[model samples]
Structures are given as structure tokens and as C-alpha cells.
Target chain A: MNTSKPAAGKAPAGGGRETARRARTRERLLDAAYRQFCEHGINGTSIEAITDDAGFTRGAFYSNFASKEELFLALTERENRARLETLRDRFDEVVAPLGRVAGKPDPELIEGAIADILAVQPDNRQWCLLNSEFKLLAMREPQVAPRFLESVRTFQQELAAMVDTALASVGLRFSVDSGHLTRLLLDHFESAMQEAILAGAEDAERAVRDNVMRTLPSLVHSLTEVRPPGS
Target chain B: MNTSKPAAGKAPAGGGRETARRARTRERLLDAAYRQFCEHGINGTSIEAITDDAGFTRGAFYSNFASKEELFLALTERENRARLETLRDRFDEVVAPLGRVAGKPDPELIEGAIADILAVQPDNRQWCLLNSEFKLLAMREPQVAPRFLESVRTFQQELAAMVDTALASVGLRFSVDSGHLTRLLLDHFESAMQEAILAGAEDAERAVRDNVMRTLPSLVHSLTEVRPPGS
Candidate 1:
């Protein structure tokens, strides 16, 4: 309640130099905020620090975001949106190799493709740390919990739909509920990555890749190969 | 380098009223620190706040702990020890009924027992959040990384040994390396519990219980039942 209200005049001007400059400044602030939050965590960060890191003053930050909380929430929204887009792009990137084959793809090719699809990003540890912190805060803070969970559900639903679409492209589908399996896989992949990341081995990526490849192949195989005849 | 050195003259007196008093005071401080850390997190908490909450002064805190980091490390050791003890107790409690019965135990009964053993602890969300934060810090801070990962490895090894002993009690064993399976199962169970906890449903515990009971039974059955013909 002590936070500043949204600035009415902060909206981007239509097809003007001011709009382009405003957009650049906003992007720079978001980039800086992301790095700061990942490095120092949410509570350790401040509005002034974010603006300073972005080479801006308090006025610039206030014009772009109503408050630090508002900025963090916007970052979450942006990250989620970017994640969904990446999931789609990665799905296509992984599956494109299998398109060379005709009907019903070979299981090994599918496994490799899925493994590629699941490979850990280099900065995954940073992202996961910040994400878990946000999640913990959202769940514990009653005011934020409902909207946070709602957004989570929506994100999961969208991811599941994308998974279904990706599967359909290959004439495959989960014997289990697609959404449930997608959520489970997402959790499994993240947990494995977290363990490997924390372990901090020389081959951390390989640790994650190997685990995902080892476990998910059988899971995918069972889902596709063990379904009962149609009811 | 700015962190306090390990305190001198902090060692407990040899088995007397003095020693008992020191032990009691240490326990109180740790209890208060755990609550504070869970509520405010490690970085958000301070030595003064911990001492104040425990009804002690800075002199008392320094006499007991070298620094805040030292206190946090001690708390981690205590939590890990407590968790291992709980695992043992829960395993025994769940398996006690089965011991009373003769002949091959019912699969449903075994599944139920395993499910009970794997159920999320009541304070799981707080513990998981703190643990994640510790892991994140350990990964990012090179100076802390080695000791932290070593402790983690030791904990996992001990837990895997306990799992082996528990399974051997029933003439069961993991088909894969017990340590590998233990690591995988730990990740899976923790991830499921985290998801359910974050969902913040009215029946979050039940949601976690149902998911564990559903996914883990088949996993346990497969791992135990599908061993090689010889071993």
C-alpha cells in the first residue's frame, strides 16, 4: 500500500522516437533486474540498485514500474512468456530431425530428440534459484498465493497443450492424461537438474542429460507402448 | 573473511550442571534460529534477531556460536540428523504390522507401507525452502561449495545405506545401484511434495500423499521385482 501508483504518462508513444527510447530503457531495466535478482535474490535487491545497475535513476525505474514488487511480478510474467515460447521453439528444433523419417518414428530417435528437448541451459541454476524463491514467497504470502497459483495453473495448462501438439506431430500420445504427465515430467526434469546443479560436478550438464535420458525413455516407451486396446 | 572465527572457550564443560545448562541454551538458540530461518530465510535473518528471539544477548550467542554462518551450518547438520532418525522410525513403524503377518506379504500392504514411509513431513515446505536456499548458495559461492557438497554426499550415502538395510529386512532390494535409485527417488518425492505444497490446496497433504502413492508403488515394485535372474 505504500508503493507508488502506475505512472499514467509512462505509456509508449505511438510510432515516435520517444517510444523507441522508452522501449530500450524498459528492456535494459528488466535485463538488469533479472541479473540482480538472480545474483542477490529478491529481498537482497532494491529499486535503487536495479536502476543503478541499468544506468538509470529512481525516476526512470518509477516511470517504468510502480514499485519493486510490481517490477518483480512483471519479470515473472516476462520469464513465463519467454519460457513458453522457448518450449515451442525447442520442441520444433528437437522434432525436426525426426521429420525425415516416415510413419511412426523410431524409439531411439524419439529418445534422443526428447533428450535434446530436455537438455539443461547453462544458466539454469540461476533461473531455478530465483524461481524457487519466488514460488516459496508466493505460496507463503496469502495476498499473492491465489493469483500466483492461478498463473501457475494457466502456465502448466499451456505447456501441456504444447506437449500434446508436439506429440501429435509425431503420431504419439501419452496413455496417461497428457497434462498430468507433462506436469510430472516438468517436475522430474527440474528436480534432476537442481540436484546436478547443486552437486556442481565438472559434467553437470551431462549429469542432468544422462539422468533425463535414462529415466524418460522408459517412461515414454511405457506410455506409448503399454496402452490397452480402445474401450 | 569478515565472518567471525570459530569461538574459543565455547566447548561444553565436562558433564556437570554447567554442561547441562550450556546444552539447554544451545538447543533453545537452534530452535529459535530454525523458526526464524524458516520464516525470514537465512540472509534475511541476523545474529541479533536470533539471540533476541531466544531470550539471549550477543554475549550468549557468541559464547555458543562463532558467527551466523556457523549457526546456520549447525542447523543444517541438526536437520539432516533429525531427518535420518525420522526415516528410521517411520520405516519401522510402517513395517511393524507386516512383521506380525506370516507368508508372502500382500503387494497392496507393501505399497501402503512404502507410501506411508514416503509421505511428506508436516513442516516440509519450510524445510524444502531453506534447503533449496542453502543449495543455491552452496552452488554459487565457491568458498562454501566444497564443504556443502561433501556434506550432501555424506547425507545421501547414509540415507542410501538406511534404505538398503530397510529393503533387506523384507528380502527386497533395488535392481539398480541402491544409491542411484535412492537419489532418484529422493528427487522424485521432493519434487512431488514441492508441487503439492506450492499448490496450497485445502488437502495439500492428501494431494501429495495420493501422488506419491500413485507413482511410487509401480516404481518400487518394478525396481524390486525386476531384478536379474541370479542376483
Candidate 2:
């Protein structure tokens, strides 16, 4: 068996031209859907709007994806992967010996991660904004709700692991509960991002920066206090 | 000077049965709108859906509110007032000593407020649900964003004032970044509410209880610990 995959743009399956055409159509749908969702919200924008925006007939939409809900799932996965990649890149650059703040938690490390998240560019903003709206849409619609819930739980767990590692390395730790605190951190950052997107002006970034700096210290202290457990 | 003017349900200056009927129709419109917005989201369901649900002509939609956005503003005010009232009630019940645990911040006060917000029955879920969605809606459209921002700022200030008073009563004589902390707490709780709504099967309230309980001790310690400004 030839395990090595062909290079990009090479068709591996039975459908060559059809696969290429489907890929282009799929991108078109996602692009159109994202813009529509941003403008009118995920639940508000219809398949008609998506197809119209993509300049494709309804058949093109049905051929590319089964339904609007399917497209939303695809968008969520696509955006989540992109966001994780962005965070991973930033996290890679933040490595240090905990430097001068060796004994205590590095306020710099935590704040830097937060600032890095805040610093992702405008293109990422649209994806984030769309993903958020998709989450809200899924919450109300029973049809799409289950898939979103699973993905969110997975992300929350991943965040929890990162928090757990950070706390352990800092030599301080949550005495009573670790998982709860991690969830709080995730929730806080998500809320901050949603607020910034809504605020939309240049000042939006400042709001996220200020929020991260303010709340993160308390979280760090709570996690890594190194104080006696019962004190 | 008929300063009393006319009741909401009463006939207006021209004082006719038609005026009274219009009032009923309008109230129905508002109720139906808030209900739909909560269930389907602000952008999800259309004017036709709202009108049909309310059993009113689509023309009647204009008769009541200027636009969907205007109706959303009304929903925002109603929800804000309702939430604030509930918060005030929780505070009233906290008393002084019972509000604080020996080694913790007065999170009983904060916890009670959250409990009040979270203890909604299935019937009342709409207000909480709609409140979250329209809050985001308020942020996306600049015209409606101020009302939501104002509501959040007001709640944040209220929490700060509550904390200040609690500290005074306990004779803790401490302060730290009240404004920033206030925003953090508000963001934390609001985000928690959003998660609770989404995590339909999971007991989010339990997690919230844990999160608040864990954070309270650090808050108290920070409050009691005093230091020289430049030391």
C-alpha cells in the first residue's frame, strides 16, 4: 500500500473534477454563510441567503451539504481548529524558565497567553464572531444542539488540562477544586471575546486587555497560592 | 393637569374602545416578540412568525413597536429591571454576619444573587435566554448596544457597592481594584449563566456553586491583607 499521500491539488478519489468543483462550492458556501451569519446571526440567516450570497442555485447547496445545520457544524470545526492553531502558535512563543518569577506563578505567562488571544487579527475575529453565533443558534435548536455541546465539552476539557499544567508548574495549586476554576477561566475569556466583538470599535481590544489583566491575577493567585490547604 | 394621565391599558386622549383594543394588541405583540426572540434568537425568527404567533396582523407589529430592534430594547430594559430587582431582594436577605463565612469573602451574597438568577423554572427560561441573546444583539448593532452596556455597567457598579458595604460592616478595612474586580465578577457570573443555559443536561448550577466558593477565600484574604503603597 502506498501510504504516502499525494500533494495538495492532486485528486485521490474517484471524482476528480467533481471533487475539485465540490471543494470550491463548499468554500463558497462557508464564505457566504459566514458573512450572512455575521450580519443577521446564524438562526436569522437562511439557506436562501447563503446560496444567494454564494451566487449558486439551491441544487449547488444541497449537492455540497445536506442542510444548513451541517454547514454550521463544518464551520464550527473549521473555526475551532483555526483558533486552536492560533493559540498553539502563541503558546509556543511564550516558553521560558518562568524566568525571574521562578518561585511564584508568572503573571507574565498567564497574561501573555490572554494578550496573545486578544491579539489575533481581524480575520480571526469574523470566524470567532460566527462561531459564537453558531453556538447560540445551536442552543435553541434541538437539531444542531448535540454536536455543538460535544465540541464545547471537548474544548473545555482541553482548557482544563492547560490550566492544570500551568498551576502545577507554578508550584501553587487550587486547594479545593481545580476543574471548576479552569471552567471559570474558559467562561471568562469567552465572555470577554464576545463583549469585544460586540463593542467592535478600536476600544474593543482595550476592553479585553484590561479584563484579562484584571481577572487573570486573581485566578493565578487562587490556583498557585501554595498556602496550606485548610488555611 | 391630569398628571395621572392614562393607564397603559386605558384609552388615550381621543379615548375610544379602539384605543383600548390597540393597547391589548400591542401588549400581545411585545410579549410575543420577547418570547420569540428568546426561543429563536433575535435574528432567527422573522416578523411574520412573530405576527402569526401573536395572532395579529403584520401591520399591528408597526402599531406597537417601531421595529424589531426597538422591541429588543424594551425586552432589554424589562429583563434588566427584573434582574436588578431579584439581586436587590437577594441582598436584602443576606443580612450582615450571615453574608460572610469566617475565612471567605461574602460570597453568600454573590452566590445568593446567582442562585436567584439561576433558579428559574422552565416557563421563565425565556427571559434568561432572551436576555443573553439580545445582550449580544445589543452589542452587534451600535444603536442598541448602549442599553446593554449600560445595564452591565450598572450591575457591575452595584456589585462594587455591595462589596464595599460588606467590607465596611466586617471591619476588614481593605480595598483592591474595585472597578476591575466588579467587572470580573459580573463577567464571571454572566458567562456562567450562558454556560448553564447551554449545558442543558449538566448541572451548571453545581459548578457555579463550586467556582464561587473557591474564589471567595482568596477575595477575603486580599481584602484583609493591607500593605504600604510603594513597599
Complex DockQ per candidate: 0.24, 0.30
Q: Highest lDDT, which number?
A: 1
Candidate 1 on B1-231: residue-level lDDT in tens? 677653666655564557878989999999999989888877789988898899998999999998776776777788888888888778756766554555445667778778777573556667777777777666666666666666677778998998777666655566556776676667666666666766775666677777777766655554553223355
Q: How much is the lDDT of residue B83 in candidate 2?
A: 60
Q: Candidate 1's C-alpha lDDT?
A: 0.72
Q: Which TM-score values does chain B get in all models?
A: 0.81, 0.65
Task: For candidate 2, write residues B1-231 as lDDT tens digits.
Answer: 666755677665657667778878877877888767766767787988889989988788886778888877766666566666665565444435433555444545445544543453223345556766776666667787766667666766776777556445544433446665566666656555555556663655565455455654444344443223343
What is the iRMSD of the candidate numbered 1? 3.4
Locate the minimum summed-lDDT window of 10 residues in model 1 chain B.
Answer: B221-230
Error of 2 at B157 (Å): 2.0
Error of 1 at A193 (Å): 3.9
True contacts kept of each: 0.27, 0.28
How many clashing pairs does model 1 include?
Answer: 0
lDDT tens digits, residue span A194-225, model 2? 66666665665567667677767655544455
